[model samples]
Target: MSWLVTGGAGYIGAHVVRAFQAKGIDTVVVDDLSSGRRSFLTDDERFVQGSILDGRLLEDAFEKFHVQGVVHLAGFKYAGVSVKRPLHTYQQNVAGTSMLLAAMEAKGVDRIVFSSSAAVYGTPDVDLVTETTPKHPESPYGESKLIGEWLLADQARATGLRHTSLRYFNVVGSGTPEVFDPSPHNLFPLVFEALLDGRTPRINGDDYPTPDGTCVRDYIHVADLAEAHVVAAQRLDAGEPIEPVYNLGSGDGVSVGEIMRAVAEVTGIAFDPEIAPRREGDPARIVASGELAARDLDWRMRHSLTEMVASAWEARRSAPVDNV
Candidate 1:
C-alpha cells in the first residue's frame, strides 16, 4: 500500500520509512528539512521538500499518489526549547496539525498514526503510565502533542476519521549506519556526543529517590518504535476500531546512573558526568505500560539498553556530519 509520511526525513521518521520499505510498501515523504536532514530520505522513495502547513502541497501529494495512510510525525518536539518558545511551538505543532487535518479532510484521508510523547503524562506518580493516564503536560512541547492527539480524536469523532496515537518515551538508538540523529537532544545521543567531543556530559539531578538518587526513564529503541507504527498503521488500514491512544515503551524505567554505566561500558570511556541541578519540568521517573499496544497492535521493544547505546555510538562514529 502507498503511504504519506510527514517529517519522513527526521530520526524517527526515517526509521519508519525503512520499516515500510522492508515490507515492500511504496511510501512518499513530505518534509521541510527544518530539523530533518534531506540525506535521510532513501533514493527509492519519492520526496517532497515542503511543510505540513502547505495545504496545496499535501492535497497534490494525496492526488498524485495512491495514499492509503498518513503518519503524522512532523512537529516541534524539543521540550526545553518549547518552554522558551511557546508560540513557535504552537504554530508548528498545533496549527500545522490543523492544516494537515484540513488537508486530510479535503483529500478524504481518514486513517492517521500520530507520533505522540510521554511528556503528556507529565510526572506520573506511578512508574508506568497507561493510556488512561491524565494528561498534565508540564512543557509546551508536551502540550502541543496532547493537543495534536485531541485534534485527531475530535476530527475522528466528527468525520469518522480513524486514528492511533502512540505516546512514546525517550526514543534512543539508530536503525542503520547511514541514518542517525547527528545532533540529538536525548540523553544517550548527548552522552555519545560528549564522549566523542572529549567532554564530560552533564547528568541533571542526582538526588531523586531512585537507586543512586538519579532520575529514571524508559528508553525505547528507534527500530522497535518504528515497527510499532507500522503495526498501528496496519490496524487502521484494516478498518479496525481506533483505540485512539497507546503508550509505546519498555514498561520499565532505567536510571540515569544505569545509563551512564552502560555508555561507559559500551564506549570504554572513563569520563565522569557532572551532576547538575534538575531542569525545570524534569520528571524523576516516567515509564510506559505497553499492555494496550500489545493487546491492540502487538508491539514490543526488542533491544536492550546496551544494544541501543552501542548502535547509537556506532552511528555517531560513522555518521556524516553537516555543520550547522
Candidate 2:
C-alpha cells in the first residue's frame, strides 16, 4: 500500500517517513520546502515539491501515487508566530487542510492520520489533559489545528473516511543522522544551539507554580511520536474505528529550567539560561494523557528527556553550520 506523507521533509514528518520506510512500506512525499528541508527525504521515496493548498499539484500527486492512506503534517506550528500573523496562520492551516481533504476525496483516499497539537487544549484548568478535555486554544496556530481536526471529523462522518487526529505536545529528539531540525524554534533545539554557540539559552518564565517555578510541558520524543503515526496507519489498515481525538504525550511534564540543565549535562557545556518574560498565550502546565492512543493504537513514548536532549545535541553538532 502506497502511503502519502504531506510535509514529509520537516523534522517530525521526516521521522515519520523514515519509520514507514523502515518497515519496508512504499511511501511518497509532498513538501513545499518552506520550513521543511529536502535533505530529509530518502532516495527511494518519490518526492513532490509543492504546497498542500495547491489543488492542481495535489490532484496530480494523489492520482500519480494512487495514495491509499495519508499522514497529514503540513501547516504552520509556532505558537507565538501565529499570534503575530493570525490570518496567515488561518489561511495556511485551515485552507491547506481543506484543500487536502478535497483532494483526498477526489482521489478516493479514505484514511488519514492527521497531526493535531496539544495547543488545542490551551491553558487547561486541569493538570492532566485527556482526549475528552475541552479545547480552548490560546493562539491562532492552536485554533487552526483544532479546526483541522474538526474538518477531518466532519469530512469523515460525511464521506466515511477513516481518520485519527493525534494531539501531540513538545515533540523533541532526533530520528537519524540525516533527519534533524536545523535552526529549530523549539526549546530543546534552542538550548542545544545556545550551548553549541557558547551563548545563554533564553527561558520564558521563572515564576510559574511548578516544582521549580518554571512552566512545565510534556516533552515526548520525536521518534516515539513518529512511531505513533505508523501505528495509526496500521490501525486504519485493519479497518478499526477510533475516537476522533488521541492525545500523544509522555504523561510527564518537565520544566524549561530542567531542560536547560539536561542540555548542559548532555553536551558537557556550562551554560546558564537567561530568564526572559513569559510569552503570552502560554499555559503554566499541560501534561497530556496518551491513554486513548495507547489503548486504541497500541502507541506509547519510549525515550527519557535525557536521551531526547542528547540525541538532538548530536544531530545539531553533526549537521553543517550556515556561515555565509
RMSD of each: 1.4, 1.6
- Worst-scoring 10-residue span by lDDT in model 2: 315-324
Tens digit of lDDT per residue, candidate 2, span 1-324?
589999898989999999998887788999998888887777766999999989889888888887899999989888888899999999989999999999999989899999999888888899799988899998999999999999998998899999988998888889787766664577777776676677888988888888988888899888888888898898898887777889987777788888888987888888677989987766688798788888986777788889988888777777766610
Q: For residues 174-279, what per-residue lDDT tens digits would candidate 1 score against the true structure?
A: 9897777655677877887787788998899899888888888888899999998898888888887658888887888789999998999999998778999997
| TM-scores, each model vs. reference | 0.96, 0.96
lDDT of 2 at 27: 86
- Please name the candidate that would achieve the greatest lDDT relative to the true structure: 1
CA shift of 52, model 1, Å = 0.5
The whole-model C-alpha lDDT of candidate 1 against the native structure comes to 0.87
Q: Which residue runs does candidate 1 get wrong by more than 4 Å?
A: none
